[model samples]
Target: MAQWTVVRAQHPAELVAASHLFDGPVSHDGAADALARPGHVVLLARTPDGRDVGFVSGVEMRHPDKDPEMFLYELGVDEAWRRQGVASALLDALRDLARGLGCQGMWTGTEADNAAALATYRRAGAQVDRGSVFVVWDELDGEDVPAR
Candidate 1:
């Protein structure tokens, strides 16, 4: 069985680890600063033996032209724990947190080819919003960078 920890990210190491698993661990300083911002939720998941197996982060967003929402900034489970409902549990917890923070809904984007993630979100009862697309134009190359 998996156990969940709902502790504020108060240490560099903890936030660093969460960023590594949850969002590629770009920079410890930047990750810490970002997590300190308002309306951020970071949850870490561990196993009975105390291994940190997963992490999820939510960021509140209020886009000018869109409704208020909470974005799944990052959600990741270790390779050994995949497909075991860790991700789903984390998301459900995030939704509850969002609701408490006055968010109407939560949103996230995964690569179109990532069927596993799509399936997990579907299992969590989240339907695709379906109207947003990621478009990138490379000024240096003067070409459109297509989704990889």
Candidate 2:
């Protein structure tokens, strides 16, 4: 059995241990600068052998008409470690972190076609908002998205 260490990283150096688990360059100085800011959070999972296996990143959001909530930005696990509870554990840890930060709730979104993600979120006790639709405006792709 592999023991896992789940932690909320407050500094880039603390995140270096699980840098490989991230898809992009998130352990550099620029990333450190970003992590040092308020709202952003990165929760990492390390194996007993000291290998980084998974991570979940989130942000705290506040609005004029609502209480604070956490937006789960991303979640990923190493291919070899999939279905081994890494994702769920990371999410649970993030929920704890969110509550500690006084967030009233936490939410995340994934494509309806992403079975793995939907399953993981379900296992983590997330409710699906079937009535909501997700849309994006890709300005960098040169597509014009008109205001609704």
Candidate 3:
């Protein structure tokens, strides 16, 4: 079984633990600061031994013309934990949090060919926006950037 945890930006230790599940190294303080910001949220899934197995991040967005909404930013599960209900649980936690904060609805986007992700989102009650195209803007080239 998996355990769910909601990490707030004010909780630095939890934020660091959640960061370990990401693909790259994350600064604990930076993560905490971001999490502390209005509308930011992170949900983590841990094993019985307390190892982080998955995590989901989201943001709350409010516009003058529309009610507040949640943007499910990302979701990831450890290879060994895939296909289980960890992802769904994490999403449910986020949804509950969003609702508590007065969000009208939640939304997330996934690649059309990513069957598992598509299925997971659908199971979580997100309607597929088939007509939408995901886009990204790359403002800088790696060659011109200084080493981190």
Highest lDDT: give the candidate number: 2
Q: Which lDDT tens digits does candidate 1 get at residues 124-148?
A: 9989756779775548573665667
**Model 3 Cα displacement at 2 (Å)?**
5.5
Question: By lDDT, highest first, what's the ranking?
Answer: 2, 3, 1
Q: Rate the local accuracy (lDDT) of all candidates.
A: 0.75, 0.84, 0.80
For candidate 3, lDDT tens digit of each residue in 1-148?
2364444334667667666577776777678687778878877776666677788889999999999999999898888888878888888889998999999999988778999999998898888888999787565667766788
TM-score of 1: 0.77
lDDT of 2 at 38: 86
- Mark the regions of model 2 whose C-alpha exceeds 4 Å error after superposition: 14-17, 140-148
Better of 1 and 2 by lDDT: 2
* Residue 102 accuracy (lDDT) in model 1: 80
Who is ahead in lDDT, 2 or 3? 2
lDDT per residue (tens digit) for residues 1-148 in model 2 = 6469897777677666566677766556866976977899888888777677898999999999999999999998989988888998999999999999999999988898899998889888898888888787557554564557
Q: What are the clash counts of all predictions, listed in order?
A: 0, 0, 0
